[model samples]
Target: MKLLKTAAVFICLTATGCSSLNHEPSSSSPSTRSAASSEKSWWPFGGKKTAPETAAKIDEAATHAWLDAYEPRLREALKDSKFTLERRDNVLIVTAPVDSSFNPDRPGMLMPTTLGPFSRVAKLVEGDSKTGVLVLGHADTSGQAPVNRQLSQERAQAVAAIFRLSGLRRDRLLLKGVGSDMPRAANDSREGRALNRRVEIVLTPQHTLMALLAQYNTPAKAGPVLAVTQTK
Candidate 1:
């Protein structure tokens, strides 16, 4: 009877130990669970990258906001000058008369009155990482074509130099001399000639409409999406 009782107790202890071993989870299982959780967080099934068009939209919106913020102030500052500031196709066009901004005969000299306007322009466009300046010089039909072109280019270069001195990036300045080629007015009369002999400063965003999309794009978060199950 004593040997049988001892055998029964031994069997009961062995059965209980095996039951606990089967029910308790393995230590490696938690690590596997952790890895799965990490994977789900990083790449959920519903996760999607930001589309190129979306990025472009953000770029457009940001560009517009910056322009709208500065346009009114610019218009107010340049209200009385021969310079006219207008927005066209998402660019700021500053039309300044050559007579007002520079010497009549001196291609490299800027007029005394031009300092004030130049300061205002520099203040508005300088230090903007997203902005670039295109300086175009025009001439009246009074001079030889090649001579006018050279003179116009020199004048444009002169203005661009001032912009460079005003803390603008040298790479952002584009200089061109369209000498009597792109006249806002016909060069027949005195008034028309004055208009034709002018410098046009075009301020454009550094990024193109499509390129901006990527620059300003944001990706969606990879979170789980909830779905309800229908039951009969």
Candidate 2:
């Protein structure tokens, strides 16, 4: 799946036009696009009121710019793993497999060790304050509700740990572990299952977009700042 996400990233789309690999043409829709992105996204989750300051980043150029900013730190954080970088329709996408070399245990919940990094688009679903929740894409209702919820929560926790490791405050990023009750893809096929196995990260408006926006604009003047930069 990580390999697929990398292949389908923005740049790959531009070069090869492999559109079917992702959710749908709608996944590239306007509403889900980042509010601060330069181009207009077809983000299915976006509102019509997306103004100049709150525009969707639908174009590949804008998404690339966004990823350009985080690549340095992200690369370093996962430097040892094979990383696939993709830019498609203005979305900076990355796919990296979990390195058993780094940590051998399977997450309490099974999902992508490295979720494709369109996570940049995860903005405050509501007014900021750092608190947010996302459903596990893979969870389904066929299983027991309690087990599903736990599974969901585990996926959330794993992603939350990742966010914390990435410097997101524990208080700021929240997760609710909604299980298979909600699914982004069909329950059939290996491809569908792979697509569904994901963790979504979201931010709230209680916090301002300034920090992310700032990072997006700067594009990290060098390589791998996450590991190399002194953590104060």
Candidate 3:
């Protein structure tokens, strides 16, 4: 299944004109590019320039490699649960229904079954020191904003405590409770409300060798520069 998915991704990238082997000439000299990069904002990944085509391929390949190592283990661990796992903007997002987390409207009491899933999540985070955890609690629009907000905050704290006990470092954990402000679905329907009342645990790298993979894959602000205007 992994191989099939990978092949499909390759095909999709090719169809969308994102082939790794494609090449384009640089518009400016190395020295000129260097000067421009210096004036740009600083990043941990530094401002080293590579040909756009090559950089795109590197970015795509690196991201694929990363998923290969991370996603499968998570899938195996949480196969029995009705949770959602996905990667977005260079982070792994795991969402669990609030029902699975604790008793209805009870933030202080964590359900016993929730411990296994939380442990698995902790193991994943523990294996990678570069990664950080962000736990966000959300709710449906069933009550006053302030009440919901406090409830969400309490739930987030409870979950973060479990993660810390499960072996994640305290400094690497971030907690937030947005309440009903960020809903996954419309709260009018039962199904939507269920989806909206959830917790999103995000695992992201604090620092990595290629932290700018997304940026490298992005198109330059100047587009494919056909001409470089020189100042006298």
Q: What tens-digit string does per-residue lDDT give for candidate 3 at 86-202?
A: 765445678888887766654545665566676677777876786666676687889876667656655666666656555676545655555676677778999988887888776
The 10 consecutive residues of candidate 2 with the worst lDDT sum are: 223-232
Q: Please provide TM-scores, in order, for all candidate models, with all chains considered together.
A: 0.60, 0.36, 0.61
Q: Mind giving the per-residue lDDT tens digits that candidate 2 earns over 1-232?
A: 6556643343333222222222224443322322222332111122331223533223345334544654454455445444444432222233332232112354342233333343332221222232332222224554665665545444445444434333443334333434453354576765555444444442222232222222222224222211211100
Across residues 1-232, which tens digit of lDDT does each residue of candidate 1 receive? 6545533433343223222112213442323423332222111112232223432223556768867976887787687777888776466678877777765565456665565676578767786677766666678889877667656655666566556556776445555555555566667899988887877776667554223222212123211111101000
| Candidates 2 and 3, the one with greater TM-score | 3
Backbone clash pairs for candidate 3 read: none
Per-prediction backbone clash count: 2, 36, 0
Cα deviation at 193, candidate 2, in Å, is 1.9
Model 1 poorest ten-residue lDDT run: 223-232
Q: Pick the candidate with the highest lDDT.
A: 3
* Candidate closer to the true structure by TM-score (higher is better), 1 or 2: 1
